[model samples]
Target chain A: MRKILLASLLIPALALGGAGCSGKKDAGESGTQLGGTVHIDGSSTVFPITEAVGEEFQMLHRGVRVTVGISGTGGGFKKFCSGETDINDASRPIKEKEALLAAEHGIGFIEIPVAFDGISVVVNPANDWVDHLTVAELHQIWMPDSPVKTWRDVRPAWPDREIKLYGPDVDSGTFDYFTETINGESQVSRPDYTASADDNVLVTGVAGDRDALGYFGYAYYAENTDRLKVVPIDGGGGPVTASHTTINNGTYAPLSRPLFLYVSTKGGERPEVREFVKFYLQNAATLAAEVGYVGLPARAYELGWQRFESGKTGSIFNTDKARSGLSIVELLSL
Target chain B: MTAGEWRGVPNLARRHWQSLWLRRLFQALTWLGVMLLAILLFRIARQGAVWLDWDFLTSFPSRFPARAGIKSALAGTLWLIGLTALISVPVGVAAAVYLEEFSRAGRLKTFIEVNIANLAGVPSIVYGILGLAIFVRGIGLGRSVLAGALTMSLLILPVIIIAAREAIKAVPQSLRQGAMALGATRWLTVRHHVLPGALPGIMTGVILALSRAIGETAPLIMIGALSYVAFVPEGPMDGFTALPIQIFNWTARPQQEFHGLAAGGIIVLLAVLLLMNAAAVAVRHRFQRRR
Candidate 1:
C-alpha cells in the first residue's frame, strides 16, 4: 500500500514534468533559436532594470534563459569573480578591493553603465520648513561626529523639534553612494540614524515620523511623493531636484551616480551570453526608464557598445581620476 | 466557627470567582490571537483580491505589475516541497523508528538524541550556508531545484524526526507484544502493527514538515534561487524560484503595485498552507478511523 501511494504521487509529478518540458519546446519555436542560460546576480537597486531587460530579452529569444538574483553588489562580485555568474548588476562602480579579487581570480570584466540613480533626500510630508539643502549642510547633518541634534541645529529658523534620521543600511550600494558623496568618504555616517536594507522600510519610517529625514534611491522617493517631500540638493551650481531630465543631463550633481553591469570576459565568450549582453545594452535605455531609473544618454550607450564589441577588459573606473566624478559619457569616452 | 463552614463559605465563593476570571482571561487571549489573524487576512484580501485573477495564476512574472503572475513561483514551490518531502520523510521516519524502538539506550544513543534536538533549533540560514557548501558547490548542483530541495530537506529533517518519534512512541506497547506473541518476528510486528498504528501520526508530521519547507526562502536564496525566473522549471536540474522569494522580490520593488502583487502571492501561499494542513487533518482522521 505504501508503494502504491508513492507510485500514485510520482505519476502526477512525472506528468507535470512532461507538460513543462513540452511547454518549453513550444515557446522555443516562437522566437530566435539561441539556447543557453544567462545568470545575473547583483545589487537590489539595479535588479528592477536588469529584470525588465532580461524579461524582454527572453521573450525575444525563448530558448535563452535569463535568471536574475539579488545578493547585493558585493555578494554578487564574490560570485562574479569566482565565475559562478555571467553578469553582475551593480549600482556603483567596482571598488579597488573587489577589483583586486577579480584580478586574483584572472576574471577580467567590461563595465557597462546602465542607468542613473539619484540618491534623494526626503522628509515627512508634514514638515514644510525645509526648502533646499546645500552639499555642506548635508555634510553637517550626516557627517560622523557631528553635533546637529535638532532642526534648529542645522538652521535656526527651521524648527525647534528634534530631528530624526533614517537611511539605507551599510550593506546597500545606495548607502555607500550617499555616504561617499555627502560625507566625503564611503560608509562614513553618524551612527544614530535608523537604517534598513529594504527601501520600503525606510520609506515607511520617514513617512510616519514628522521630524524624520532620510535618503534613498530616487525611485523610492518618486514612488512615495505624496507621503514624503523631497529636498532638492545644491551642488555648486544651484538647487536641482532629482528628476529624469536633471539626472540624465548630469545636473543632479554628486547625488546622481551611474548604475553598472559588469560582464565576465569568459562568460562573454559564450554566444548566448554575448547576444544577451547585446540585447541588454540595446534595450537598457527603454527598460531602465520603464523601471523608474534614469536612462543614460544615447551616446553613452554607443560608446559602451563600442567598448564591449572591442573586447575591452578591466575597469577604467578603478583610477582616482575616474573616481573624481566624471559623467557616464565622459567616463565612457576615456 | 464550625470546620465545614470555615472551609466552604467565603473560601468556595472566592475560588469560584478566581476560576471565572481565569477562564475569561484565557478566552480573551485566544480571541486576541484570532482577531489579529483576521485583521491581517482582511487587509491582505482587500489589497490582493483585485490582483488575484486567472491570468495572475497562469502567467509568468513580468516587468509590468499588471502582467506579473505567480505561475513559475507556484510551480517551483510545489516542486521543491514535493522533492523535499520525498527526500526527508523516509530518512526521518527510519531514524525515528530506530531511535525509539531498536536502538539501545546508551551514551552514543543519548548523544545522538541530544544532537538531533539541538540541530532543530539552529538557524535556517546556517543550514543554507551548509547546503551551499555541500550541495551547490561541493556536489556541483549549481543552484538547481535539486540543490534547493536537498537544502530544505536538511532544514526540516530534525523537525520530522522529532515529530515522528513522538508519534511512533504513542503507539501502544501492548500491540507490539501481542504481535510478537502471535509468532510474528520483530520486523513483521513493527510492519503490521507498530507502523500501522503510527502511520497517521507520521503522515501528520510529514505534511506539517512539507508545509514548513514550502514557506522557506532563505536557504533557497542562499543556494542561488533566482528571484526573476520567467520560465517554469522543467526538471530538478533546472533553476527555480519559490513563492516566498517571489513575494519578497515583489515587496522590495519600488512600485506600489508590486506590493499589492506581493499580497496576492501571500494569499496563494496561505491557501497552499491551509490545504496542506487540511490534508494532514484528513489523513490523520482516516487512518485513526481505520484503526
Candidate 2:
C-alpha cells in the first residue's frame, strides 16, 4: 500500500518535471527556431561524411532531427525514389533504371557531388615484383575466362606463384565501379576469386598471403599501409598512385569517382531541409577530409550550391562513359 | 581359438567400454564450447579495455574515434527494450493463458499452435520486412522509437507466447480445482492461483525474449533505424539508434581505432544483457521461495 502511494506521487512529480523542462526550452529560444526532421538514407561509402554533417547540423539546430541510414547505394535509391527519404547519399551516379523509377514517381532530385573516392589496388607486402599495373593488365586479370593464372603468365620475369585474387562483393558500389572501369561492364569478373563485402576481410586476406592481390576503397588501403603495398594504376598517360592530392586533382584516372547527394525537390522546398542541404555543402569539404575521403574543390561546392539553389533537378552525366575522362568540376559545370 | 576367446568375453565389459568412450567424447565437446566462449570474451576484453571509459558512456558518437561514445545508442536501446517489454509481456502472457487454460482444443487451436511454432522459426529479417511495410509505412510512424518497439514486439511475440504457454501449462491442475472448490470463479482462480505459480517462469521467458530483441540489428535496420543518432530520443516519436547498429557502423569503418570502439560497444551490450538476466534470476528466485 505504501509502495502504491509512493508510485502515485512519483508519477505526477515526473510529469511536472518533464513539463517544466519543455517549458524552459520553449522560453529559452525565441528567434528562428526551426523544428522538423531531415531523413537521409544511402550509401555506406558516403555515410561518414553525411553523418558528420548531420552531427554538426544537429548541434546548431537542436530542434531539427537528422537521421542517416546506411541502406547501400541502390537500396537508398529505392527509398529515395519512392519519396520515403529527404536525401540519398550515393557513391556513384544514379543508374538509368533508378532515374526512370524516380521520373515515374514524379520525384525530381538535385544531384550534388560531395566527395571523391578512389578504388585502390593493393598487394601483399611480400610481393616485390609488381611495380605498377596497366589498365589492360587489370582487365586481363579480372576479366571473365582470362588465362592469367600465375604472376609468371603476366610477365616472365615474375615468380611462378599462383595468383590469388580478392575484391569487394557484387552488391557493393565499389564492385560496380571497379568492374565497369576495369572489365568494361558492371558485375563482370572472374568467378574464382575470394570476395567479401567487408574490406577489412580483404585486407587481412592480402596481409596473410604472399601471392594475394586485392582491391578496395582507398580508405582501407590508407588504414593498412604497413601490411599491404599499394599498386599504382596506369590509365593511359602514366602510373599514378592513389593519394588525397591525386584523387582530388583527378590524377587517379579511371578510378577516382565522385560521391553524390540526391535531394528530392519536394524535400528541398522545406525550410529545414533547405538549410540542412546548404550546411552540408558548405561543410562537406572539411567533413569529407576528416572522414578520410577526398573533398571536392571549392569551386565544385560553389557550383553545387548554385545548382541546388536554382532547383535544377535531374542527373548531369547522361551516360556512364561520360564520367570516365571528365572531372567532377567539369561535369558540374556542364 | 580366436573365435572361442571373443565369444567367451563378458558382454558387460564391452558395454562398459563403449559407455566410457561416449562420456569422454561428450565431455570433450562441452569443454570445446566453453573454451571457445572464453577465448572470445578474453580477446574482446583485451582489445576494448583501453577504449572503455566514463566519457565513452557519456558522449555521443563522433567521426573522431577518441571522442566517440555510446551514450545515445545506449539510451535508445534502453527505451526500445523497456517499451517492447511493456507492450509484449502482458499481451503475450494473456494469450498464453487463454490458449493453455481457457481456449477449447480444436482445429483452430492446432492451427494457431502450429503457426506460432513456425513464426518462431522464421528468420528475423522477414519480420523486419513485415515491420517495414506495416508499421513504418502503413501506419506512418516514420522510423520513430514507437515504430521500432512495435516491430520488435512482433518479432519476439512468438518466442514469448510459446515460452509463456509452457510456463502456464506447468502449473498444477489440482490448484485450479482446489480454488474452484472454495467457491472461487474461473477468473479469480487463474488470477490468484495459476498466475502466481507461473510468474517466475513468465518472467524468465520475458527476459530471454527481451535479450534477443536487444541484440537484433536486422529488424531494426529494415525498419529504418538510423545508424547515426547524436542525441538521445526524448519521446516515443523521436528517431533513435541502438547499441548493435552503432557497433555495426563502427566495425564497418576502415579505421583501426573504430574496430576497438566496436569491441567496447560489445562489452557494454554484454554487460547490459548480463544485468537483465541477473534481475530475472533474482525475481524468479523470490517468487519460487514464496511458492
The fraction of reference A/B contacts recovered in model 1 reads: 0.57
Candidate 2 per-residue C-alpha lDDT over B1-291 given as tens digits, one digit per residue, 9 for 90 to 100 = 343366757675667779999999999999999999999999999998899999999999999899999999998998788778878887898899899989998999999999999999899899889998998889899788889999999989999999898888899999999999999998999899999999888888998899999999999988889898877776677789999999999988999999999999999999999999998888789888988
| Candidate 2 DockQ vs. native | 0.49
Q: Pick the TM-score winner.
A: 1
Interface root mean square deviation per prediction: 3.2, 5.4
In model 1, where do residues sit more than 4 Å from their true spots?
A1-32, B1-4, B8-10
Each prediction's DockQ? 0.53, 0.49
Evaluate all candidate structures by whole-model CA lDDT and list the values in order.
0.88, 0.90
Among these predictions, the greatest lDDT belongs to: 2
Q: What share of the true interface contacts does each candidate keep?
A: 0.57, 0.52
TM-score of 1: 0.95
